[model samples]
Target: FLPLRGILPDMICDSKSYIDLLTIYQEKARKDCELVGNYLYDLLQKYCSKNVSSKAQLDDLVSIYCKNSSFLNVVRTSELKQEYRHENNESLKQYVEQLPAAQQAPSDGDQSESMMTPQPIFAQDCPELCWYIGLRLCDLFHEKYGRYPGEQLKDIQNGSEDDNSREEMDTDQRQIETDLHDLKLIGKQFLTDHELAKHQGGIRDTVLEELCRYGSCEIHSIAAFVGGCCAQEIIKLITHQYIPIDNTFIYNGIKQSTALFKF
Candidate 1:
């Protein structure tokens, strides 16, 4: 489960291994759900991201390859949304006193120059939030329609012999595209809709592009690495000892390389 994924991110972010993180993580995870504690062992093994009405039953599902476990055992969070906002906001506040003058915004109330802060509501570019949004879109589309975007994509490219099937596929393609368009509006609207993130915006288009590229594959090593990177940035923020990431970070596991971008 989803609940285990929530807790695992914290553990991964801390740079603790699966077995090593068991002690503290077990407690934190259990605190989230008693079923999580009961199923902690299996959850630590191979787990599925299936629908679970209850933690106990959710843990019971042995189907679906828990592919992420290796990365989890090696990789691997909550309402991903809530955890992300809280972590970013709390960490940024702690970093204010530590940042250099150039990094910090002027207190003179000048709106001419934009400001970037850890505050989720005030963040200029939060790839992490956008990342979650992309994943959410993937899940939403799949659940609403029985097929994935990728699958439909394949069907379209391959072409269907049956006119009815082909037409249906075209309809699916249009619907998915509409969903993507809605995602853009959702990102911008979310800021205005929720007074909390007012003007914050919904999500990023680049994030959406990435989700389309990757489709349903949930890469654990990548996720865990990102978690670690976030942890490091937050540490730098709290200690004010080092420069926190002023730009978004990108890692290419295929090439085993990393790059930073300022947007």
Candidate 2:
């Protein structure tokens, strides 16, 4: 069973509902099989940070996630199944540009950053690529493992509560507790090894080839590739602008490549 720490951060990092957000994202992704992208990692890092407040609203959390360039690229690339093109495409861009500036009121003559301040890219076109890839990953997990990652968490929580309630714990609770004991086991076993390996087998080399061919390997390399190829379809719906078809153009090209890999 995966622990809350294992997956909660990723779900909360997106602008999804915090209560059961992980389950929701997993379910949504499972149903759509798209919407998977780097936004999950971005959200995990932002919400899981030591200093960040845990009580952020969904929009605030989305704003925070959108602020980061990596996350924005993910969003731009991720795909969505639903078709929702705006009638006034130019108006959408203007509205995005005119989004209220982040409130910067001072507190006690010390300029304390407003918690709800929107990032420059928050109102920009949603990160369709990240969302699509993330969902696809979740769907892959369910198909392979025959269970959602969060189900293990629910089992752990239920087992722990049952253990706590019993005057003398039973074998079932003991077994459940033992099963849920090592949270990282799933990350090491499923996410890193199995899921990531499958993902790599399918697209990792293609992504690498594209990056190398373009002579740029910045974070945006993956973001833009994922965005243009995966997110362009979705953006067509949201913006209703006839985006010119891209012909294998790399957004952030770099010659050097990193050997270290982590999910």
Candidate 3:
């Protein structure tokens, strides 16, 4: 889902000066984001002193950093009390004009191919555990199969299929579309595989057809549900009121099932 793994370094390399600033705050918070942010603000102070002359420009710089920084996803919502206005929680996209102009992505080709600024991981970095593994697999598929999940579905489903299709999509919708496209294709591959016979209930054609029906779906019900749940947990931790769940929540709307497990 995140292009961070295996490709993030190249993205961040688009901003080596800012990337070097990260070295000043690595592994420095319990969440490990606070220290990095402090370091970022310090470097920002120096940069702003020399280059940024206006609050608007400074906001733009900070906003772009918020959108690209690895720590951004961890901090923006939970730490910022965003209350789910956006998922991917890009509370900062409004501020980013482009990846900090301190360094720009190498302009070797068209903007489409150069959209991503890949930042590589470091030795001390903690591994990220995302639930959307299928999406990650699709990224891998792009390397071997020579197509992104979105491109795969694009072959079959016209993205602008709906009347509102021409509508502008925000960053979060774009992110979700990319992931959903991957999920649909990966699910299709899994369904066709004879080895994965244990799982059932997916009528392959019907499932894929349904997915295509909403080819450009940007549904956010799940975002609100998940966001509210997370906000509740954060409040509990801050107010020291009701106890939070121990861990793991498994929700399956299609099966109408829910399970909670604590290890």
Candidate 4:
């Protein structure tokens, strides 16, 4: 939607001073186009029409734009390369030549640690609301029973038969109830009286209550579904250039009760 065409030529002229500027423009255009394609695909069902407007139409537009942009970048880069060649900029030519063949290997420790760390469900600036809820529920469980609920819930979700004792089952249920109580507390702290009344017995209310009372086992099946929805929304925000993302917001969900962070 933005008029990138007008600025492209000025930044991409065949000149030594503009080489870096040209590369930056090309990269930004490629990234912006990809983001647009992704956003359209994710929200197509909600906003697009089946008869006239469709994901396919959006995809086609993105493909055409990308193709043209890619061709233009190639041509521009080639021209720059030619200018360098003419000027006998052998150092720059050698650097370019080495780029395609050179590969960097991570240290052994780096590889091992990277493999062990779980991939974040959302972009670095995107908050994992469900996970935040889960962690808060875990803390509430710990307050009541002096132990985290994560281990027990993990066992149940993983279908581990070894921990199927009656005692464990009862403990798990109690933990869920405690989680539900916490959710109510959270809701009361955040929502106005009218807003809370509207959702008193609704699905959202029920889910929040259940999550607080019982932990993820009560909603483990929907964890991935909820996470994916949040990820989709976050992607839309980033791609649309909606706002500058903050890392702290991603780490901590909206704190309703206090202005200051407790931890």
Candidate 5:
């Protein structure tokens, strides 16, 4: 996992939910191993043709890869607005530019001179941004109810409740609905408490809904696929014979597609 210290603001990274967010996240699995394999094989052939054998040459290659591949680069690519491409390198520029005119960054004249509002790395419509916020909200939900979105109802069902009570409260359908509602509430409160509603607006409901519906379950196939990809990357790191992916890899199991984005 990449350190988020400089990737996100201290206010967010220091929050309790942020810690929990690290523990849980949308699975970013990499697929299409053959594509990566082919790419590596080509690079290896090129390397062999050059007859590069010096430690200095290898160190230069590793440095080049490290510079290009980073978690922050992927986040910036996915969340940055196309129009704001020129401002992408500005450290103080807000990552999310969807704030309403009235809530935008304060002008120099509006400053109190000693305090400034901390800028956040959230976007209203971006899937990557929503996933981060939703995961944190899920953590907040866990903090509040002592159960994840869908687990509360499961616990209730297993409790010593009478049949009538179980019939009323324990249905899977009802639990699904409950989970959705609770997650929405938690999401709203999170935005409000953090004063992000005025900045980036509410997170997309679809992201939260998906999280609630899926709960914490993992598809075994996806898990195995991720493990295999990670192992491959680790081997490449150890061997240093072929260039490994420079950063973010997204795999869609359903689509049978994989994309590698260099950060």
Candidate 6:
């Protein structure tokens, strides 16, 4: 049977930056696990259509999976061995600092390495994809501002004691406009850095506006639906009976539909 693994991260300090970095790392690590599961299932379907094969055949499939899906494409050369340690503490520090300085260049390294950087594929027609892209932008906003968009407005309004003065309203509007403009700037910089600026159209303003208004608040209805879905997916994985999501799963509560994105 294929092995299943769970994350047990290394010891981390109690600082907020480190905590935020851990969250991002965990999200990326979870995505990596899903990618491996999907790749393995596809490989099995391709090789063993009817039933499990001989030990030699299974061994070959494992080797092929390793060669194709190993992190960073490290298996491109059989002689290349991956070393994991705390040798890159400086790089980690830069990464944590990058949240506040979105335009900063990545720390120096071997620029010629074969690394996978998924370019932004913004499609105006796909709301799910656009929403996903907006979520990434929201994450960047959090990194830079240490608060989600609209959060400051919420706090200001809360502290106003229902006065609803013109000055307060104008301040809220100005804050929102500033946040939206900054998000757009960061998104553009991200696209340029990833060489995706030449794409036909960038993210739409409406998407950014919606995300700004959201302020990353958790809604109970959406949370309940997502939680149920997660439970079902976990059951599927444990039972090994039905196919789980391939890679990306998007749920649009507005549209009341779910979409699968395989990349």
Candidates in order have lDDT scores of: 0.46, 0.34, 0.40, 0.43, 0.52, 0.58
TM-score of each: 0.30, 0.18, 0.26, 0.25, 0.40, 0.49
lDDT of model 1 at position 94: 31
Residue 29 error, candidate 2, Å: 46
lDDT for each residue of candidate 1 in 207-256, tens digit (9 for 90 to 100): 55444444455589988998999999889768955556554455655446
What is model 5's C-alpha RMSD?
A: 22.2
Clash counts per candidate, in order, are 7, 29, 13, 7, 0, 0
Worst 10 residues of 5 by lDDT: 113-122
- Residue 257 of model 6, lDDT score: 74
Return whichever of 1 and 3 wins on lDDT: 1
Worst 10 residues of 6 by lDDT: 75-84
Tens-place lDDT per residue, model 6, 1-263, is 33322333577576786778767766765555556656666766789768745444555555444343423221122111111112323322332222221232244566433111112223323356556656767877789889887675643433355556546766766777788899999778755554456441435565677666666778899999999999998997799545666655779877787876433
Per-residue lDDT, model 6, residue 150, is 67
Q: What TM-score does candidate 5 reach?
A: 0.40
Preferred candidate (TM-score higher): 1 or 3: 1
Order by lDDT, highest first: 6, 5, 1, 4, 3, 2
Off by over 4 Å in 3: 1-197, 200-212, 250-263
| Global local distance difference test of model 2 | 0.34
Candidate 2: deviation at residue 60, Å? 38
Candidate 6 residue 164 Cα shift, in angstroms, is 4.6
lDDT of 2 by residue, 1-263 (tens): 11112134533254545756767755653333222224443565678766443333343444333334232222232122221222323322332233333332223443332211211222112222222222334444456666432333221223445545342334333433333332223323433432343222222212222212222223655676656656775776688545533322222223322111111
Identify the runs in model 4 with alpha carbons over 4 angstroms from their true place: 1-154, 157-164, 193-203, 209-263
Rate residue 241 of model 3 by lDDT: 58
RMSD of each: 20.3, 30.0, 24.5, 24.3, 22.2, 22.6
Cα lDDT of model 4 by residue, 1-263, tens digit = 44142134644455766876767777877677777788767677566546446556676788566655533422112333343233543432332233232123323454323211222222222223333334544555566666543234423343435545545655655655555565556444332322323322211332344334333343443556547656876885678533322221223322211111111
CA shift of 89, model 4, Å: 59
Best TM-score among the predictions, by candidate number = 6
Candidate with best lDDT? 6
Better of 2 and 3 by TM-score: 3
Q: What's the C-alpha lDDT at position 24 in model 2? A: 70
